[model samples]
Target: MPLAGGAVALVVTLTLWLSNMSRVPYEDALPTVGAVLALVGLAVLALRLVAGGWARAGLMSGVAAVYILYLPVAVFAVSPSAWMRGGLLLMGGVAAVLAARRIPREAPGVLAVNRKINLILVPIVIGIAGVVLLRQIDLERHRPAPDQAFAAFDGEASATSPDVWHLIFDRYGNNATLGGAYGYDNSAFLSALRKRGFAVNEEAFSNYQRTGHSVASTLNASYLDRLSSSAQAADWVPIYRSLTSSQALRFFERQGYETVFAGSWWNPTRRSGLADRNINYRAVPELGRLVLGQSAIGFALAQTGLAYGDGRGDQCRRATYKFEQLRELADEGSRKYVFAHFLVPHPPFVLNADGSCRSLAKATASSRRDNYVAQIEYANREALRLIDAILAGPRPAVIVLHSDEGPWPEPFVGDERFLGRDPVAVDWAGLNARQLAEKMGILMAIRHVDGAPAPAPASPINVYPQIINAYFSGKGVEPAPRHYVFESDAALYRFKDVTRELN
Candidate 1:
């Protein structure tokens, strides 16, 4: 009986451990394939124990206790969801009582029996095997690989245009915002790109307000409407074992370019576990580490905002990581399409090496300006460093320093004409998830160019198609409509006919 109970415990442990190791979030109420199989093994153990004079009630009760009380607290923390919490507590209590019933009442006999239960070797062996097997499979099959499609395209266009480097400066808005709010002339940025002989898109908007949605759309050259419709929690894992995976490295695969995803951000990569193949995460090892540290701060900041899990940390980290990855991509000497996403000129404004506030509780307009200037200065420095790195590469490259969205707090922007007044603050009780995200500064995209074309009005959604049409179709297809770029408000949506205010 004890042996059988040990086996059930082993199965439960295996399921939890394996699922967590896979980094798959528990949603949809369906256990992963491995977890399901492990449960079956536990059921078999339960049957065996029941046959050998095990108290069914006690064994079941123990199972209930572990699942209800222990599992919920370990993951979700203590909450006032009493009905759910009560259910778990009940199961745990029952399991404890049932477990007690299975042991001999006599203390000595119970001690002897407990000793034997602990000595069971088979279940322990099985548990070890489960951990090793799950981890090994993840290591072997899911790493990043060269994108064949990207490679094919690279071969086809090795000499047409310089190597394309799409550098995302997280959420700096367009020229309008930069010029109006900061009072800095964008002519320097524009002039720099023109000097490098590239056409820049001054009017660009992100199809989605959030970085992951926009970045994914840009990388894939597809629309967010298509991808978001199917993105599930499991899809968020680092590995792409599931069928719904659609983060953009695959597009590069078709083009035959060696694609690398290095960043400090957490994205679908956390779930896809495909870092081994076409989406390497450790591209800029040191920068990746620093970005990760920044992400920790980003996460804490989120707790105070509306979008509970906006993936900013993931996006920020990814941006920094991608910058680091350039060195490796250059070293590989493979025709490459590198997407370097950097989260700068964005906030917490807390990541400064010198550590100072960009704005404070009583910040005046000048103080706000000072804060943003510091951030822009930092972003510009990083941007220059990245461009130098790309130019220093053996091959000629087309580097694009772009932003996903603009700054937040409409008042700091001071352009009542362009940005609307800040959204009304909700009472504490009225606060919902979306409000939090807005406060934290989502939905801003800025573009500062160095080697790319002069700025045009654009969105991230247009980036891929623009690149593909330029490089792949060779004038076969017309450019996507400028207005087709995705934009967002309280509700995230595509900008079918957005107000083109930069004029």
Candidate 2:
């Protein structure tokens, strides 16, 4: 029985760990592993107390088998509801227990068959785990390095090198996009920004459609295609590294300024070890947390009311925590380059326009368009408050309010289930014109403390370069070319020049 429990624990832990090894650290899997093992151990002990001999042994083995296979069944099975999957597993377990009670205790043939099955199963599980571990290790070893060669501005830092604040609001659409799609007029938000001396770009579009590519290009001041080859397109590790440890942060660090980051719960922007200071609200390790959220055990816990709340509740907590931290930064006296990325107006919409938590039931019941508008309205209110606080601070700051990428459109809302599909096969011609435009259209506005010589560019790629040129060195940075690039959901690293397609 002990051996059976150990085997089940090992197989389940290894499967969960290896599946998420690329995104999360090994240590993060320890808690979930321990919890799973403990649950299985408790179940075995309970069955032993109620039944003796072959009945106990059979029931223990049955529970172990169900636990081990539960994740695959829940994830790959036709049913999407976690509750439905859990109920199915529970029924299977009960059936196994009942059947085990009928087996004869003194049967030599039964004992021999059970012994042989255990021996075979243990070795097979171990071999599968070993293979997965080795493959993950190979993928980690071959991860690509980010491009570090940026045009350095060798100018002295004067009292006029304004404290820069790069504020990114995830999936925020421009006024026109908001109005056209969701019937929400965002001009009030734009007017508020304009009132604060920000040069709002009404016709601005993101250089890339995805967050990883858009942020990577913006911070590096170059496109991902130019920086790295297509070989690293399968994963997001390279792009994540670029966002955290890019030339942009390094540039500010060299200019006698402290780089403080208020990152979101998302892996790419969560916490930057490269920055002088990192602030995030998620207590658990990121990769492990994300992986656990998708697991069968995690689903069971959530369904049984053991969890704090659903994904919507967690999103609200993160968004609120990040925003509060941004508000407090107004009191800091140091010349700091603060980068606060807020995941708002995104999916799992949790907020209403009035700052009250939207009921999870209501949010889920609402249409995607309704949920988006509610969050966007809430974000607008919060953004204005943060902007006011920053502008009222003791020191002058250059604030760039932008979005990593615009809101996803119809038939392609924010779900990533389509990642495995071939990008080349997707019919780009069938994409809706308004939806495509909205996806490409992002919120971009910049406020220079002291008036700048040049206007802010439409593309995020030129944002950092323009800042360096305007304040640090009086030299001119060339404008980004008037072209849009689109990459498919499956192949994020592979680029398609969709400039003419959009036009």
* lDDT, candidates in the order shown: 0.44, 0.69
Clashes of each: 93, 0
Candidate 2 clash pair list? none
Candidate 2 C-alpha lDDT tens digits along 385-496: 8888988888788889898778777666444211112112334335666756888788989988863433666678878877887788746465554434444544655566
lDDT of 1 by residue, 1-503 (tens): 33434344444444444544433332211233334345445654655464343334234433432443245443235645646554655565566556655656454665466556446645574767667576646543433222311221222343454456666665565565566656755567556555545456654555444455445545544443442333332232322222113334454555566655443333333323333234444332222222222232223333443232323333334444555556556645556656554546655342332223333332233455555556576665556556666666676655555665556534333421111132233232222333222322222222222334344425565554555555555342323533232333222333332323221
Candidate 1 Cα misplacement greater than 4 A, ranges: 1-162, 182-191, 224-248, 269-325, 353-372, 410-457, 473-476, 482-503
List residue ranges in candidate 2 displaced over 4 A. 1-10, 13-130, 137-142, 147-159, 227-230, 283-287, 294-297, 304-309, 414-433, 451-454, 474-476, 500-503
Model 2 TM-score, all chains together: 0.77
TM-score of each: 0.51, 0.77
In terms of TM-score, the best-performing candidate is: 2
Reference-based lDDT, residue 350, model 2:
73
